[model samples]
Target: MRFVSFRSGADEARLGVLEESRIHVLHPGSTLLGLLGDDGERLHEAGAAALRDPYDVLDLDETRLLPAVPAPPTVRDFMTFERHVEGTAKLAGPDGRVPAEWYEFPTFYFTNPYAVIGPHDDVPVPPGCTLFDLELEVAAVIGREGRDVRAEDAAGHIAGFCLLNDWSARDLQLTEMQIRLGPAKGKDTSLSLGGVFVTADELAPHRSGTAYDLEMTATINGEVLGTDKWSSMHFSYEEMVAHASRGTVVRPGDVLGSGTSGGGCLAELWGREGFDAHAPLGPGDVVTIAVEGLDSMTSRIVAYSDRGR
Candidate 1:
């Protein structure tokens, strides 16, 4: 079942489950994390029970959709895609290797949940980002809170999945990494996360392999920029979960991102060749990222102006 957080007219954000294009509103206190904490059977039952006529809840177009999990306890984005890692490394230098530390410990970063925008929202072009890039990723929401979980048993803790666009300011990222301070300013700028919020059971079939057959595509200004498959990742979500649960407690509502996939963005796919010196993204360019069986998110890149704020 698909879940969402949304607001309509003057109402506050509320949780709901999707039932054949209709929405069945959950209780006021019910949240994505709460449902995750429920066992698979219980979750299924709850979703089934909530099924009702779509119009009975609210009109989809009239509602203001928010991030599926608006306030996750913590957000960890992992660099588990091998193609992205290798290609990104090559861009930095010819000698870069998948860092040993990345394998031993899943490399991740804390992102701003407040920066997350819903589908169709205006994704403001940050102050001076001439090289804005898109990273197609899958975000996993934690269902069970745990500490030091074993890698083999990590699958049970996942609550659901959501499509994520790890929007990047390439120029900022390169500058930040140069200081060796990690992806502070480079990554902290903005993070677009939305599309369908599907449950773990829906994606169980593709859980085992380092990669899956899921197709990914990115379009800028109605032009296809990147296309690839999820099977390009070097590591699986289970390993990242296991690594995250080590030493610290992971709570329900925590989000884990599958780093950029190979060919996920122009920067990684075409390197310096993709950039158009004369025509950078202006105020009206639209970007759409879609993954088959998952969902598609479209955002309009608007210039940042003081009056708009």
Candidate 2:
């Protein structure tokens, strides 16, 4: 079942289940993660019972949908994709030999929760940004809070998954790298996340690394810019969760981002100069990233020229 956090009229954001083309409000006491954290049998029964008809509950188009978990206590974005790591290494480091620690553990970064925007929202291009890029990724929401969890038991902590676009500012990223403080300015400023939240059950069948063909495509102003397959990742979500919870507790609403795919963005496919010289995206541009089973996230670039003086 699809779960969402939304606000209608003057009401505050709350949890709801998507049914047909409408939304059925989940009781105030019930939470998406809490339900999933319960025992498997109990959780399944509750979810099935909640999936009853939602015709007269609420209009899907009329309400405003917010980020699935607006106030996630912590957001961890992992670079588990080998292609992304090697490509980024070539761009940021020497010899393309990603730090040995990167391979030994799941590397991640924290993002600003306040900067998150929902589906169809406008993404403002930070001032002086000529090279804004989009990274298509899959994010998992932590359900059961745990510390030092074993890799084998990590899957149980996942509540659900959602599509994420970790927007990037290429120039700022380069500038910040010199300090070695982390990707604060390059990443935090331009990130736009959302689309829809799909329950873990819906993604269970695709977990086996079998023939699950999840495809991703990014389009700009109705033009297809890039495409990639999800199966290309070198690491799985369980491995990321295990690494992340090594010495700390992961709580409900925590988000884990699967790094970009092979052709996830132009920066990785082509060098920075090539991207700047060939595929420069400016103001008034709209970017839409879509994953096969997951939903599509669309954002309109608010260029410097477009902003009010």
Give the winner by TM-score.
1
Score each candidate by Cα lDDT.
0.74, 0.72
Model 2: CA > 4 A from native: 28-49, 53-56, 92-101, 210-212, 304-309
lDDT of 1 by residue, 135-215 (tens): 888888888877888878887887788888888877887888888776765566567778468887886586546646788
Candidate 2 collision pairs: none
What does candidate 2's lDDT look like per residue over 85-192, in tens digits? 666666643466557777677778887766677776677676666677888787888878789888788878887778788888877877877897778777775455
Name the candidate that leads on lDDT: 1
Candidate 1: clashing pairs of residues: 82-234, 211-231
RMSD for all candidates, in order, please. 2.6, 3.1
